[model samples]
Target: MLPFSGNASPLPRNAGVALILALAAIVTASGLLLWLQARALHRGTSAYAALETEHLRVAAAETARAALYVLAADPDLSVDHPGEDWAQPLERDWPGGIHAWARVEDAAAYVDLNNLACSNQPGRPFSAILRNAFTACGHFEADAPVDALADYVDADTTGDYEAAFYRHADAPLLPPDRELWAPAELLHVHGFSPALFAPPAPAPDARHHRDELFGGDFRQATVLLPDAPDAPVPVNLNTATREALLAVAGIEHAATVRSAMSLRALHPFQSTTLLAAASPDLASTLEGAIDVKSAYYRVRATAEHDGRRRSILAYARRDPDGTVHLLQWLEGVS
Candidate 1:
């Protein structure tokens, strides 16, 4: 019996099946080639990015070294002010689509967060500053933050906001009960949140606002310095924001802060004596919480090559002899 009844032919049916298999093979080969090409392209892009990042890192380091030189060349070691060349921003472009930007900031111009851990004092004077800062920046239980921070940093285990409180969070963490290493670490402490530290919206018109006091929103105005235990970091009179000046013990009056800032604007206070002599009302406030010189500075730099970007953050100290020493250097910082 012939398998093909009527006019059916086995040859045509076999040819059709072969044709379908050949088409399937072609489609599979094409898909495989496409995937391989895509993977190669991704690899090339990743390689280029890594190389660009390395180059940018070197560029950022060099820029920071140059900034240190600029800081060291200041003639007046007795004073540090924004009028100096080191305070200016740096922007430059190289021939190979490479661009760099750097800014030098005075660390003394900010409120130091580590001041909350005054281990020796019966009453932490800087606690008032942090509380005031919280009130100014957010609408939370102001005292809660200060007290919680104290618990986090204080050498004590018995507090309402101690390690036990943090243990109940979704991702439990243990508080070191030590000074904060950076400003961002506050997010880990109780009574602190991202909302409290987020910066305000940028101006649509691209305008620079000069009236901000330090720690207003906590993002740009606060710092964590490894200051001596139980000691409050003094705010620099020449460069500190009005908020920083207000946080000082005796400098509470707004009018007095304004008056001193006005005097500072006219001429940088060459000495605390000069400030006191100019205004007796401010003399007492300047006794300990303020100074005319800045010992600490931060160098922030960003480099861009083609479409890739990298950043570096650094902290440095400047001596009275016009020598600058790098304390910490962080790469790939935002």
Candidate 2:
């Protein structure tokens, strides 16, 4: 085994070990460099996402303001219908490839929920409208949500669907006992579910369409006029759907509603007198509850860039003089 004679062997045994160590060091350094590059890329993406959110927010806000201005520019505020210019949706293409869209809907086209809160009595005229809506939709015990919402909105604790009913669930809950901050808060009340508020699926037939009018499209048939519990928003005769019109008045004579719809389709009703001439009985029933114009409008605005999007829901009041005042602004609406 001592074939090597001099102090130096053919080669040092440590040389092989040194080579392995050098290769390992190089590999480790390469791995570290790759990791740093990946981390930098991740940070960059995050930063870009944040910036995009800000840009979208600004664009969405701009869209909302532009929509309100469009509403303000309407030449005639005496009457508003879907055919009006302001009722048309607005869209714009910004310089930076960002796109925005906005639209306004007659808020009075639906039953106003805050009106129920204002009365807190289910059988009153306004509450009856909500009840009739549920009935039209074929909801059993049509008064259930009406009463439940009463408990949720009233300050007093003396209601059948009040706070106590929510306490025994797997997760106990308590109502705020105040006006709702938003329509979505209805989910927190007893006897209300997410399914109830979801958009109605399209129906293929006439019979199914009638049933979906209020029952399945409950969310579309009702609204919560922001911070307006005491002042009632009248149903716009020029814009209210047949279901909504029947809710305010009664469907005992659906023929009456059909006649009104038929007449309005031919030409928009200019005043309550026109409705009175059509049917004195219907006019009487809808007296203070109806208007040829809408004061409240719901505005939705959205912006998108690079497949990312942002949105806002705006509630506003339009005065007869074409003035627009924003009542509420909700961000993060899809």
Candidate 3:
């Protein structure tokens, strides 16, 4: 009481404790606000990235379409040969670290699987050709695969697998009995495996390279469906591989097929007349089976942006009136 000073008492213990608690609450609120802001920013960035990736994909697809239009407008649409503008790969670099590329392939050069079974006949010539082609590709029991596929698409009840066969299976599935919408649908057929139809591994030596040089490799042959189910699909002589020619003409006509390959290499056939003049025997044999032009083309487009990638596969069908239409489009390849 004698030491009373002008200054008031320092403070109550409870008051000091309350002040400390208030400071702690303010620190916690600041930290939580900062965390919420960071989360919002992260989500916004992610959404923008996804949008950019999709835009890049669409741009790549349009580039491929424009290239196809250019090809359709060419006056020499009668023949699809190497070194043509359409045959060359298209590549483009855009702003913001984006890149795109595309390539065109002749769909008519490949054997049409739809042509084989659409007739509803199991033992058609196309089926035999498919069997032979698969055999040459190193598949064992090739006939089983061909027969199973024929049964899958043929309308007739007479097939390798009948209704009774599917009834006892675990999945209890029946044949589609219709044209195949896509080549990959073959995997659903019995005796057809991915390993058998996959692209062949690269050759290890010069001898293997030489063997593949003349299209002896079965993997070079593509499996495509015809654009028009009712019309007969013809092979493009200008683009058909030697293996395809052999499959169509039979092994007995090997010499004539080799001759045709040589002639086409020198000068791609401009028309069926040119092909006939080059190899009369083979031409006459493949009259209705071959053509010098391709109405169907496959286009593959790929795009890359900001460490993201997208790709699409499209089929372009050119009409007789010179109008090109997109037959199919498959996206998100890789």
Candidate 4:
């Protein structure tokens, strides 16, 4: 016989086990809900961070462009290009509580791609410089190939310069190289070497400061030789090589001419001497045929964004009074 209690009952072992299982299930469900909520929050936070970084990058680019506009518009600014001592952060002004600064790079501060001093032949003296420019830009050529660009653009050429560009095996329908608007494109050319293109390393007692070098674009080795109005340097018809004469602006030849020796015999011509001494027929042919001056000049600008920094490349021309005009801009450089 067992005594029965009024307020108590004997529980089955199975019923007690059932109660414990129910409690365990609730605890696991609660934990899973919390984990899911935390994951959602982390994803939202990551997305917001990415969006903020992009906005900051765009702001940085705009800041650079605005500073460039200021440099171009200021009348009091000096005519000196970026490489000169005058180009500095003080040249620009920032607005709207935005912290901004800039560095002007002289395009001429580096080796000029247009300089035709390749084998030292007047016709092709710029080969080495071109090669160097290409080397500095290793990826450009393998991706986009242009074989004989310099030869095609100069004053005299036998045919269309673009014909020489080779097409990639992947896309033979398209030309390997594209048209170039700036000397920086040299880095995009094929067979260029980095060792040759990089500026000579800084010397222990370097007269030029690092700021000066970083602030400019690379320049071409060849500059327009001064020429008189009527007699400009006669790009030799018989002696000039095809590469040297191709980009001469106005010279037209029927076929590739070998003029290495002939060009050496001919002295550098100013318009005054060249026009008078050249055959009348030849002189008449080249009246507006040559560009006695070079159109390219280097430019640079810098800006700060999100506590980070960036640089830009610009090619430009300036009037005698320090007013600058844009030729090109390298955007979003870090």
lDDT of each: 0.74, 0.78, 0.72, 0.40
Q: Candidate 1's residue-wise lDDT over 1-334, tens digit each?
A: 6455777655566777898899999999999999999999999999987777788887777777777788888788888888889999887665457788888889999777776676643333667666666544443377888788888887678788887898998889888778777667788887888887678555446586533443255654467775443466667888987666666533246566677789878888888786667667756645556778888899998888766777889888787787888777889844
Error of 4 at 89 (Å): 1.0
lDDT of 4 by residue, 1-334 (tens): 2243566785566777797898898998899999998999999988976665555445555655555555555543322233233345533434533344554443322333333312223322334333433333332242222234454333343323343443452323322232234434444344334443455455456675433212211222222221111222223322222333333312233121123224433543323234324434434433422322222344444555456545665566544455556656666646
For model 4, how many clashes? Answer: 39
> What is the per-residue lDDT of model 2 for residues 1-334, given as tens digits with 9 covering 90 to 100?
5435587665456776798899999999999999999999999999988888888988999988998898899887887877888889999877579999999989998878777656533323676777777766656576777888877877788888877888886778897777776867887776778766666556767665445334436665678887654556678988887778778767585677777788888888888787677676666667667888988998999999888899999999887788899899989936
Model 3, position 26: C-alpha lDDT score? 91
Candidate 2: RMSD to truth: 3.7
lDDT of 3 by residue, 1-334 (tens): 4233468776677877798899998999999999999999999999997789778888788768767877777667666786578877888886677788888888878777766655632222677677656655555487776777777777787865756566777788878777777867777778866776666666777665634333256556546653545555667877887767766666666676777788888988777776566566655556556778877888888888766788888888887766888888889846
Residue 238 of model 1: what lDDT?
88
Give the lDDT of residue 278 in candidate 4.
43
RMSD of each: 5.2, 3.7, 4.5, 12.7
TM-score, candidate 1, is: 0.77
Candidate 4 matches the true fold with a TM-score of 0.43
* C-alpha lDDT of residue 204 in model 4: 50
Cα miss at 319, model 1 (Å)?
Answer: 4.2
Find the 10 residues in a row with the least total lDDT in model 1: 210-219
The alpha-carbon lDDT assigned to residue 311 of candidate 4 equals 60
lDDT, model 2, position 8: 61
RMSD of 3: 4.5
